[model samples]
Target: MMKTFLIYAYSAILVLGSLPQLRQAKKIPDQPFARKAKSIYRTPATVSRRVIEKTKSTVTVSGHEKIPDQPVLFVANHQGIFDILVLLAYLDKPIAFIAKREIKRIPIISKWMEQIKCVFIDRSNRRAAIKVIDDGVESIKAGQSMVIFPEGTRSKGTNVQPFKSGSLRLGTRAEVPIVPITINGTYKMLEEDGGRIKAADIELIVGDPIYPEQYQGIKHNQLASDIQEIIINSID
Candidate 1:
């Protein structure tokens, strides 16, 4: 219990302390913003790795070399809150997330997410959600990679949930490659024990990227199911 408290406390301090840097990076011009944001990512990445170590957990990542050089849409199964931390800490690239609108309410954390170009979607409002998708596509086309948890919520276990096909538009509309990632064991870190943090071995598997040409003619629903199956089968 104390460990969990310390983790949150430390994370809060880290986010608060990075305000000056975030503000400075936010001033960069649009043409150079992506480069500046990538450099700024190191701060959050370090903080994420430190927090994971504080939990006394081990992460085994595989197939990361499969990620392409261009900005691609990362579609991953949602296992828990730590899923984001794991990706931020371990992935060797700078990427933003398509997060829920509620997260935008977070104080300093939301500012940092905005610095990284994260798109927040209001799932309850159809028109607003469509706008969010369009914004995400533009961000991807502008050379900023993004991640989406199509399950729309954490499964809290290894049982992968069905992905909502609408989120796939970020990839299809941008004409970028779609990379499927499978995250297992994050739930045991927090959600499994009812919010108490615990030591757990986590696995993050990066499957082969599905290029635009490959998924060009497929329906979004079918594509969502295929990606879901890939994630489900990747788990132990």
Candidate 2:
């Protein structure tokens, strides 16, 4: 328990200590979106690495090279908070997440998310949720990849839950590729420990991209089932 506390204390220190990096956002006053993406990603990426190392967890990744250069939608199952840390640390390109609206109130962390183009969905409000989807579509067109946890909430590393079909539209509507991601073992880190942190091995599998053109007439729920099957099969 003490170890977990110290690790999180270190995280808070890291986030607060690195706050100055936000000022670098203006370095190239008229910079393009890609350069700005780098500025937004740099510090968070470093912090994610540090957090993973501090947790004493090892993440084994496979097929990361399959991730395309062009903007694509990442459809991954949610495990827990560490799932986000692992992705931010290892995924090669700049990617933003579609997260819950409540997370936007988190100090310092939320500010960084805004800069990275994260879209916060208010699930309770249909209009707001639609607006979030529109925002995600715009972000992808402007050159940033996005990740959606279609399960809507983390399963805490247990059996994967059914995916909600609506979240898949961010990729489909944008006409970008949808990449299925399979994650396992994250539940053992904190959730399994009753909120305490423990070291564990995590496996991340990146499946092939599903191009929009290939499924022109398919229903969203059917597509969700197919991707869910892919993720379930990929897990250890």
Candidate 3:
């Protein structure tokens, strides 16, 4: 009973603590400086002092320099909510995510995500999904990269699940390079199946870029699988 109570308390605190940041995020504009202030300023370097003080959940990244300067599609393994925060804190470049349409309803976060030009996909509506992909392709053409979890949801474990081929089409259609990234240990930080969160070390290993040319004549589903394999192999 005591442990359960503590877990509940911890969850409540985490939620409430994030509320203020989200509230502040809503008031910010969708400009570059606003994004820099909201996303870049409250980064890994100063997050210990400003946001969550649990610096114990450290993250180490590699192959970031290998990222192409031009916009590319970043397809990574989904672990937990922590993956977003981890990337925001560590990644030097400004990138947006392909969030669900439901997240757009959240009070402050929705606004923040919108201001940052994050693409929202309504998977339930086929037309909307295609439109979202089109918008994402346009964003890439405009030199803004996007990070998408091709698994479509948190993996809830160390092993990655199958990739959804829908988002993969954005990369190929736009002729953008696909960068496969492996994110490990995030599920330990905050597993979706459970509400509780625990401090855990995180690692991000970015592999070499895979151009559409390499996958010439390959099926979209097979392309997604090949990319997922690269991410899974990088994790361990």
Q: How do the residues 21-130 of candidate 3 rate in per-residue lDDT, one tens digit apiece? A: 66665576545443344363352223422222352567788999989877778889988877887776676666778998889776645655664568998889999988
Model with the higher lDDT, candidate 2 or 3 = 2
Per-residue alpha-carbon lDDT of candidate 1 for residues 1-236, written as tens digits (9 for 90 to 100): 89889888988888888888778777876676567657878877888898899889999999999999889999999999999999999987888998889998899788888878899988789999999999898888878889999999999999987789998999999999999999999999999999999999999999999999999999999999999999999995
Q: Candidate order by TM-score, highest to lowest?
A: 1, 2, 3
Residue 60 lDDT in candidate 2 = 92
What does candidate 2's lDDT look like per residue over 1-236, in tens digits?
Answer: 89999999999999997778866654544246666786678788899989998988998999999998789999999898899988898776788999889999999888888778899988899999999999999888887889999898889866899999998888889999999999888888899879999898998899999998876789999999999999999984
Better of 1 and 2 by TM-score: 1
| lDDT at position 20, candidate 2 | 83
Most accurate candidate by lDDT: 1
Error of 1 at 113 (Å): 0.9
Error of 1 at 227 (Å): 0.8
- TM-score of each candidate? 0.97, 0.95, 0.79
lDDT for every model?
A: 0.90, 0.87, 0.73
Error (Å) of candidate 2 at residue 234 is 0.5
